[model samples]
Target: MEKSPTTHVEYDSSNAHSNGGDAITRVPTQGKDAVVGTVRLLLGNETVLLPTPSPDPKDPLNLPAWRKWSILILISVFGCSCVILASGLGPIFSVIRADYPGQELKANDLMVYPTLFMGIGNVLAMPITAVIGRRPIILLSMVTLVVSSIWCQHSGSLGSHIAGRNVMALAAGQSEALLPMMIQEIFFLHERGRKLAWFVFLENFLVGIFFFTSNYMVSAWGWRGWYAFFAAFNGLILLFSIFLLLETLFIRPDDASTGQVHLTLNDVGKVDEEGANELVFRVTTKDKDFLEPEKYGVRTWRTDLRLWRKIDNWAQVSYFYLDFLKGIVHPIFFWLLLLNGAYLGLYIYQASTFATILMSPPFSFKFNSLGYVQGAQILCCLVFLPLLGYAGDHLIRFLSKRNGGVYKPEYRLPSLALPAIAGVIGAFMYGQTAAHPEKYHWLGVALNYNIIFFAFLGANQVALTYAVDSFPLKAGPLLVVVCAGRGFISFGIGYAVLPSIQAIGYDGSMNVVGTICAVLAVAAIPMYYFGPTFRKLGQNYYGFGASKEHANGGSGH
Candidate 1:
């Protein structure tokens, strides 16, 4: 490896940039064709690493494989715990309504309201996380989750219990935005799909498993015991996070590009004759050398345990909310907002009503055995886990190879096809079967319900992953748009679904839902074909693909 002469550089930790959009905008581009920036392939035209890693061992991107997976598992478990806490009320809904007597509280208010706040909570979390760090936000939310669970358990009034659940939903909302953002921070582009699938799989799988088991818990110890179970689970997660969860935000020195660093095929050939791949990409700046892990110092376990990280540019905090609004309007973001919301709303509506429909029909399902319906979803997830996990990354890699090693975010869009198709078919089957329980066996409802969940799992992984891939640095704000949009939209759907079912009947309501899914499905055709052009048009409008000069005084990259 070659060495560059070292020179002292003044550090300015103060905020200089008005918005941190340049973090992604500063990546060098080839042209309009390169809105996502082009990757200079290896000698064999292999896919180049995106958001290139620094030499610092302390960089999350450079962490060992075991360490990265460990953190991912911990975060996934935390997210799963939140899911369990948020949805436990559903299985025990009958018991709660019986206790409340003649109160105006209904199933939607109990379930939909908290679900809505989860979106509200997601929006609230981003600004704070943007300012402080992800670790602190996780710990803070976990504390809220624990307290709210206890409050929900011991509530003296119907209103108070509902309020407690809303608070718990708010706390649980952090998992929606932060978990995906953290996964993006830790994993490379090639690995994101699979890792994200791992997180979603755990969440969806646990939701299914919890529904299956929650009734038994309620039967043995009452609905309050459900709350107690999650409170303890959350408490344990809080402990694990305090010691094992490290901060993933890695800030480069002021001289380096805030955008991802990459080396071309030519640049690789310029390295020393030893052919050391580790030292090949280190030719960064005039004064400072890249790959200097020693300068950053060794990160001891104590350092990893730190909750708050220094933000070199606090001015970036001011832009977090504004970027969220901007992201809401960005073409791709808006599309995903709708796509995610429609699927999530459909799923929530089904889960909320699945029990009521089954237990009250001519088919007459036993309350104790209602969980058997969710077993189909669990099996679907188990089958789809490996498929959804690896398929997106694999498909894009193949597409990238065929594109002469230039990867486009559009490659990720194609995978949305599965969910879109599933939505249309599943809604039709579920709606028709649910409406006529006498003609169709209850198994029809269960099997189609499984199909809807399959769509939910696929849509979630693809939509979230594509958005992050499109706007890598701006993931936090973009996810706020995605998570909050889905939450609010789904909340509205949850609030209205039962009324719609009552007014129009299950078949008619599902026909409307199936039509909406069809429209979204059709929209994907254009999105896959013209997504890059749309992205190019919106890049400047959204503060993406801009030059480094746009970074102004630098937002610490």
Candidate 2:
């Protein structure tokens, strides 16, 4: 073995991995294709997270400055566009009703079918992704979306439109779940906030843009034209991205190009048992090799013979799955679920009710066509776009640095409280305006959309990102459950909104929404203040300690 000038441990290929005997350090392969930070060398194969300094000229890990940002914005925009389009059906419901004409149509059902398709699609897409691989799935899904868009252009009957949406939703979920994992690989933690900003910015903008598409096409060219436009746009995306968007699945560290740090491969490596766990004993080294798990003589603990028996590929997958499943009951996820449910409910209500709300007397906004009113609500949604997009992300970065470089998921919340209050105000204004139809017409258009979803747009980002940051490896399954809950809960809310308005009266309905939002706002306290404590209490895999403590036999694991 060779000695180094400083305290750094010496490395020799001969003695590097002795019998997989002592994997002493926690190798931070936190996610598949996810690169979070650096690794440290310790007592023969020991694992511990050693936060390194930001890229200096001499550091090998310094990312490519010029191209990284450019690639990030481009990727984020594409990802956001795909996501926003999934919800685009909201702004065009009247067109759908008129065109399709269901026997018993309801607002909630409208939201349910499309997002249901998205939910079902997401539920199925993961294994398909694992089996088929990311590239083929992406290209094929895009093709489905493109074909659906074209079919929608010709859709005169209601049934055909629903079919088209099903196809589109199925394909769209790929981009939503897959892109962020790819983004995390190329960027550093310090710049992650900015990467997320671009992602959210485009997401909010595209959602607004999808609504306005109906304004121009519905009355002038008819509903079919709307399909043609998006189909054509989707085609453009497919063609442009085919070569520009490289397959980001697997890239070896040694094979990487110059100027990029290749040392962080463990963070991005896909976990499997085949070769990664293969042990090579070091007989020549003089230093005491860390004892292999096999020596413990516990049947479950063995690094050689069954080398990594308890920590093989299945273990990795099972461990991550359990971690994600357990997150839902955690106070953070439970509270986040409440926020998400409220936001989605509000979003569905605003989107579906826009047609009625805009036309009420105060605004007296009689459109030459119904699409005009949807466009107006969409415009109002756009008003909060910039603020919602950047505020939380900006705050996350500031607080991250203030915490002496240790980033907590809770840091994503400083700007979150204000939006909750805004949601309450929006609901209150909308309800009272609807309740007093003749007197409060003017303010209703702006205020009635309390579910304009600005709070949702921000909160969803914060919650999901918090989950991802806290439980890096298990984030996939946690999000899967969260997304499933979001879709299911949204359906219930969508079904009830119109009826609630009818039964409760507009003012009463909004008052209910305001109260829910207020409670969620308050609930945010326990999560922010006691989140770390609870995380520690549970030995959860949803945070840094999760990997260390929850590797074997926890409640769910």
Which number leads on lDDT? Answer: 1
- TM-score of every prediction relative to native: 0.87, 0.71
Can you tell me which runs of candidate 2 are displaced by over 4 Å? 1-85, 100-108, 127-134, 249-323, 360-362, 368-404, 447-451, 537-557
lDDT of each: 0.70, 0.52
314-339, model 2: which lDDT tens digit per residue?
A: 34445544654676677666677677
TM-score, structure 1 vs. true: 0.87
Worst 10 residues of 2 by lDDT: 254-263
Q: For every candidate structure, what is the RMSD over all alpha carbons to the true structure, in angstroms?
A: 6.4, 11.4
Per-residue lDDT over 1-557 for candidate 1, one digit per residue giving the tens place of the 0 to 100 score:
22222211121233221111111111233333456433433224333444555555677876778888888888888887777777545556777787888774453477778778898898777677766678898999999989998998898888888889899999999888888888887876777888888888776677778778877888888888888888888899899889888887665432232233322232444443445321223122121223344555776887788889875356665677767787788878888888888888887777777777788857777766876677456787776767778887888888878876567777887787877798779888888888887788886677777788888778888888777766555666778888899888888888888789889988888888778877976787788878877667656576654322222111213
Candidate 1 ranges beyond 4 A from true positions: 1-33, 37-46, 104-107, 252-291, 311-314, 546-557
